[model samples]
Target chain A: MTGTELKNVKVLAANIRIDILKMLEKRGYGHLGGSLSIADLMAVLYGKQLRYDAKNPDWDERDMIVLSKGHAGPGWYCALANCGFFDKEWLYTLNEGGTRLPSHPDRTKTPGVDMTTGSLGQGTSTACGMAQGLKLKGSEQYVYLIVGDGELNEGQCWEAFQYIAAKKLNNCIVIIDDNKKQLDGYTKDILNPFSYEEKMKAFGFDTQVVPGNDVEAIDEAINRAKAVKDSAVCIILDNIKGSGVKYAEELMANHSVKFNTEEMVNKNHAAIAELEAFVKGAE
Target chain B: MFTLDHERKMGKRELRITVADAVNELMDADKSVLFLESDLAGASGSGKIQKAHPEQYIQVGIAEANMMGMAAGLSAVGFKPYTHTFGPFATRRVFDQVFLSGAYAHNTINIFGSDPGFTVGPNGGTHTTWEDVALMRTIPGAVVCDAADDVQLTWIVKEFAKSEGIHYVRANRKAVRNVYAEGSTFEMGKGNIVKEGKDVLVIAAGQLVSDALDCAEKLEAEGISVEVVDMFCIKPLDKELIIKEAAGKKAVVTFENHSVIGGLGSAVAETLLEAGVSVKFKRHGVEDRFGQVGTADFLQKEFKLTSADLENTIKGVLL
Candidate 1:
């Protein structure tokens, strides 16, 4: 968590924001709030935390990441492209016909995505499974999971939480992006998930609450999770609905939106400029 | 309905017991083969494996969705995982996981969906999965299979152990009437023509194989030449054998222990249509009805899936 590392991760996050905005803007509609909210965490992961070979994406011994809230795929795709998992040119192909990158993460098609996930609760379960599998093989690899706060509405996520703790899958690290917004509206208006830390602890996880916007805290939480031997860790990453983009962040509910109209396109461009200014601050 | 009168339900425990043993042996041979249960180890007749190989058998505790993810995770790291539960729980309960984690990820995990369709009997509509075959068939590259008898079930468990990707193995927990002889070989995606004739083609699967055989025998004795084919592999259907045996026959009657709409009959109808062949065809099974508590005879009479129903359907088609 050095200053240089923090700045580098911040730049990466800012760049991912730009990538996501540009891609979705061109596509005219996509998940914005969830994708933007997770950018910093993805930045810290691909930039400083994860140990992977971009050249050998399928290396047998490499650690894994399954984005259970897979609608945030554009943000992850940006991170992978920045890390050289694939060419950056492929990012624009998001959700298009014959594109490897779809609206959801497909491991078979995408280069760096470890598990295929679009359905909310399924990824958490798969991450737990990967943790157990890696343990059985006696591999020291970690399975990193990024789950959305709203995604917890699916009962499968809780089922996965219980299984991970029951199996004592300490090799897995779950980060809950408590952005507090979903497709319909605010999570409170939809289904109020009061406290993730308490719920996670009840499910037998070694839980922590961290500032989602802080890369240093995210990095530290990941390391802390790795140190625990008998219990899995759940870090509730408290974040703003839209992290860096002002236009997106200003929306009362920017969950999944469209920029198909002329006014929205101008607003999108303004958001891009705002993200660019944020990168200068990182420098 | 379909009745093999003198033959009792003797093979149920024997087959289940043998499966438990085979699973244990497979686990012993390969450290990677992990066995998972959804708190149904006792019901699935694997109490011995539970006691013997405690490490191998993981009781996922009524969490079928999480069980699927656990199996997928185990498969990701090169472990051959066999997830066992009743049919409805395995397919309908956690279908999204089976689709994304299991099939889409191309991870290898053998799912044993025991007690398909009416075999759950008293378990009723809530427990029985008449739409599992239809549901599983929709998944791309998924190997959907239904066991005909004791030998086929045993063989499928062993074969799918080494095969890759998501595979569905649906069968009854009870003893099935043995059809293939000991050491008889079977191929995936290739239907076995158990009996061949010119007048009628009877394609059958699961516990209904015996009923189909009985019906074919009765029809044959009545001077109607009947052919019976065991369509064990339902998804990667034996279209070659289906066309080879069924296309030119006087008529085709498909028998299954599932709904007539999306099970074996639908697959056969779609295949014939795709191949551009016109033939008199009828699907003999539960005619779009929810299951109820009864003997297979009573249920079959209610749903018209018995041998008598098969005879009537065939006669209506041919005569």
Candidate 2:
């Protein structure tokens, strides 16, 4: 990607991070770490890669996104809102009673969320089914399945992965966010998924690893994945648990954090201000 | 319109074959109608459909939870996905997925769980599921039904083709006694009164429906008038029919192939109590026990699920 194109996506990523922080902070507590980690990828999807219309979210010809690691719904919702799928003000009502933006991605409730997911590995199978449906219908549309590294602990993910690889469902691109940390601790300390690239390769996927928070790299990786024809494709994003939020990245309990303390509230405000400035400068 | 076959002969078509034929007809009619099996094509009798309509059939291979989510995914993309597996796996094993992906997500999926209750035969306790109806009833907007014959099972599959949301229809794989006649049509959420009487009302579902009718016939020979109503649709149960049937009856007896704790008995009990239609009520079935390895007949007797058990319950209730 060119410098200008990369900058554009980075700007998109910054805005997504800002919105996520604002929403979570407004709600006082939520899944902060996971949402922040996927901002760059979400930006790459909403900014350059995904073929969707803001006016018609359910357009048949558009490419779909299934946020399998649905706790990161703030990031997905922010990206969709930035792309005009819904009002940006709706982000403030995240997880509130009777709100459109739920704590997890719900296809029926959210505009751009193509698959309802929060129960970890179930979305992998759903994405495979969506891909198979597209193939059966002879549609060229693609489904981007966003999965968390920690979410792979679910056996259903492996079941879905095997099916996808065996069926050669190239239309569904599997993107695993290898943020290393889960709800409890580091994934290695917990389940120890060893090497995702090796595992995906053994599972018959044409695998690629890229920095999670890098806009240009993620964009290029997705482009490569889209070009593959014969085998299923998987991209592993190797990056921090809280990619853009330094305070959360350094904090041990960053997964579902409460900004109850004065320090936490201040830190969140400062982080959002910095990202907002970056977006403003890019614009 | 809710009459019985009365002859009580077993339907010529096995329920598995009936389900397969209905699914095949659905596939032939609509390109969007798809069938998914979890390595149970032969068990579900959909292997032929799988062979003929490979594009429309998905063999997910032993992943019941994944199959449910996959069907939800297919549903999201406007495909009417019909998923088949054993009763336990379909409801008990994949309850969360069915609740979240299928029902909570508002996706349309028709789940056909074969070999429910005692129908599992020697597949044993692990394969047997007596809580499917109870589990399915808890889900919001889920349509739960139990098939007593091929006619009812066939109508349910075809009816669900145009119906939206989560639907679960449990039936036996082998041929059972015909509760409804051939070419019989059914109204969803309405109970079928097989026999009318004022002495006692026997509300039953699945394999127990035929037995309940036989028990009613036996009681009639002994100068006792008994009513047998097929409470097939357990979720949006035929409350009107149940309330109406329970009125002026001497006693109410619920017989089912499931545990008496939550299946047809619980549903009927709740309906009767809530409607204030007080009567001598008895929930006659497995009393909070796990299924054991045995033939259907042996297990039925062991669980006291035969017509004789219904006769005892009816007599006990009348007294």
Candidate 3:
């Protein structure tokens, strides 16, 4: 990716972080770690990589994507809103009663959410099925999945991995956000996954590990994955628990942030202000 | 199960074979028909269709939950996918996915669960599922049907092809008696009255439908009148016919191959309660208990699921 393209993605990712903060602040409490961790990848994919029509969200020829860790729903909704799928004002109504944006990504409720997901490990399997169905119908469409490191603890994810490999669902790409933390604590302290790449390799995936926070790196990794046909690819993203925000990263416990307290509200505003300043400086 | 006396005496085809053949016809006719198997296609007889058309068949190998989510994903993309597995795994193994991913996600898919209740001989408690109907029907907007014969089964498969939303059809793995004629068509949310009598309303589903009819036959010989209703469509419970036909009868007797707690009996009981109709009801089937391995006959006799049991149970209700 060119420097200008990389810079453009960086600006989009920073804006998405602000969107996440705004939504969570309005809702008073929501998943912050997982959503923030995937902002860069979301920016690259939604900003440049994906082939979707904002007007026709169900366009047949477009590539389909599933956010396996659906707690990151706010991040995805922000990406869609910014991309003109809907107005940005909808982000404030998230998690409210009768809101289109629920706590999780629901395809029936949200316009651009291809599949409903919140239950861990299930979305990856659905992605596999979607890719297989498209392949069977002889469509050149691709199915991309983004799963969290904590979410891989679900046996169904591995079940999907084995099935995709066995069925040779080459049209699918599974990106694992190795954020190294779950809702409880650090993933290593909770339940050690050891290495997702080696496990995915053992499960017969064309494995690749890249810096998850780098938009340019993820773009290149996806391009590389696109070239490898006849097999599914698993790209591991080594990102922080809270990628762009220093307060959440310092506390290391912002898995679900509630800005109800004075300290938390101040910290959130400062973080959003920092992101906005970064975007302005880039310009 | 195939249906009707004329078709019955003419060397009837296996019930599962009818499902496979109907699905095969569907695959040939519609490009959107996709089938997912959890390594039981051969056992369920869908393997025949899988062999003829590999493009539409997907074997997820023993991962039933993944098959459900996969089917949900396929449904999102406009493919009308049907997932097949043994009875217990179909509902018990992936109940949450069927609810959240299949139903809540607004994705439409069909699930065919074979070998319900004691009919899964030798595979034992782990394989036989008496709770499938209860669990399946409980899902909001789920179309739950317990198809008694191939005529109903074929109609259901075709109906689901053009229909929308989640559907679950549970039928026997092998042939049983035929209740309906060969070319009979069925609409969803309607009940089929096989025999008409005024003394009692006898409602039944699955393998027990034939037995329920036998009990009704024996009661008729003793100069007692009985009405038989084949409630294939369990959900959208056909309350209109259940009330209309069951009017002024001394009682309604529900017999099923599933547990009496939440299967056909529970549905009928709820209907009777809501309509505020005072009808003495007798619930017969597997009581709240786990299943065991034995021939269908042995399990039926042991579990007190025989026509004789139905006869005694109905007699008790009549008095």
Candidate 4:
């Protein structure tokens, strides 16, 4: 990736992070840790890799995304809005009554969200289905499935991984965000997911582990995954729970946080200002 | 209106084979119609289609939840996916997937839930699903149906193929007593008065439709006229027909091979009560009990879903 391209993608990630914090702050409380963790990967997708038409969100020939760990819907929504899939003003309507921007990614209500996911481990299987369907139709489209490390506790993810491996659906790129935190507590305390790399290898996926915050590495990993022939592929993002937000990163329980407190709101405001300035300078 | 066939003999083709044949016909006509099974291809009689149309067949192996999500995914990408599993596995086992991924997502898929209720038979309590209809009915815009015979099962499979939304068809895997003639067609959300009379009305579905017919015949011999209606479509139930038949009748009874709590009986009760057509109503089914290990006949009697039970229920309401 060129320096200009890398810088542009980093700016895209910062914009996504800013939007997510803004939307969550407007809502007073939302899923923060997991959503913040996937901002860079979402940037790598919407900014660089994914083939989609914001004008024609239903474009049949475009690549698709299934955010399986749907608590991170804020991140996905920010990416979509930044890419002009929908108006940026809609982000303020998150989880409101009669709002299309739901707390989870709903394909029926939202534009460019190919699968409806909130229930963990489900989108993995859905992605496999989409990949197999594409292969059946002989279309050269990819399905980028973003799964949370915590979401893997649900056995359905493993079931889907087994199917993807058995079918060798390289068209479905399995991206696991190892943010290491779930709703109740840390994933290691809740359920020890030893090593994502070893598990994906055992499941027959050619795996790659990359720093979650690095947009360049994420882009390169996706390219390598696409180049592999006749084999299932996976990328494990080794990221912190509250990835881009410094205040959220140090806070012990950042899974879902309230922005109602003055300290938290001020901290979020400060972070958003910094991200916006970075984006402005890059642009 | 449905054309009722008075022939009470067994259908030549097993219900599973009938489902398989209809699905095969669909796949043959449209390459987009995919048949997905969760390692129950042989049990569902879809193994034939798997052999013939390997390109259109997907065997997802024992993961019911993943299979449902996969079906929804296939539906999302413009493929009309038909998924088959036993009743419990199809509905209760993966209800969240069916609701959120399939129905809520508007990624519609046709689900064929085989071996409902007593039809599961020797598969025992673990496999028997007495709550599938109730569970399926709870899904918004989900079309739920119970096939009584090969003819009806074939029509359900073919009709739901073109229909949108989450369509669930519950039928037995083995042969069921034929209640409709070959080439007989039925409409969705409509009921057929197989045997009409004035004294009482018995709304029935699934394999119990044949039992209800026999009970009506026996009640007629005893000078008590009984009307038997095949309410195949259970979710968007034939409320109009139910209200019409239930009004001014001496008694109303609902018969099914499922639990009396939330199956055909509950739907009928809700419809009749809401319509304010009050009558001596009774639910003749497994009286809120789990299934047990037995032959189909033994389980039918054990659950009080036999013709004899229907007669007793009506008598209790009348005499």
Chain A TM-score for each candidate, in the given order?
0.96, 0.98, 0.97, 0.98
DockQ of each: 0.76, 0.86, 0.83, 0.89
CAPRI band for model 3: high
Q: For model 4, how does the per-residue alpha-carbon lDDT over B29-97 read when each residue is reduced to its tens digit? A: 999999999998879899989987999999999999999999999988989999999999999999999
RMSD list, candidates in order: 3.1, 1.2, 1.6, 1.1
DockQ-based ranking, best first?
A: 4, 2, 3, 1
| Docking outcome class, model 4 | high
Candidate 3 C-alpha lDDT tens digits along B135-165: 9899999999888776777898778887778
Candidate 1 vs candidate 3: which has greater DockQ? 3
Please provide, for model 2 over B1-319, each residue's C-alpha lDDT reduced to its tens digit, 9 standing for 90 to 100. Answer: 5456779797787889999899988898798999999998878899978876888899999899889999999998989999999999999999999999889888988999999888889999999998888899999999999988888888989999988899999999999888877778888998888888988988988878899888989999999999888888898989899999889988888888888878889989999999999788899888888887899888888888889988987877777
**lDDT for B117 (candidate 3):** 84
Ranking by lDDT: 4, 2, 3, 1
Superposition error at A21 for model 2 (Å): 1.6
TM-score of each: 0.94, 0.98, 0.98, 0.99
Candidate 2 CAPRI assessment class: high
Clashing pairs in 4: none
Model 4: per-residue Cα lDDT over A35-93, one tens digit each: 89999998889888999999999998899999999999998999999999899999999
lDDT of 4: 0.91
Give each model's whole-structure lDDT.
0.85, 0.90, 0.87, 0.91
Candidate 3: pairs in clash: B2-B178, B3-B178, B3-B179, B4-B178
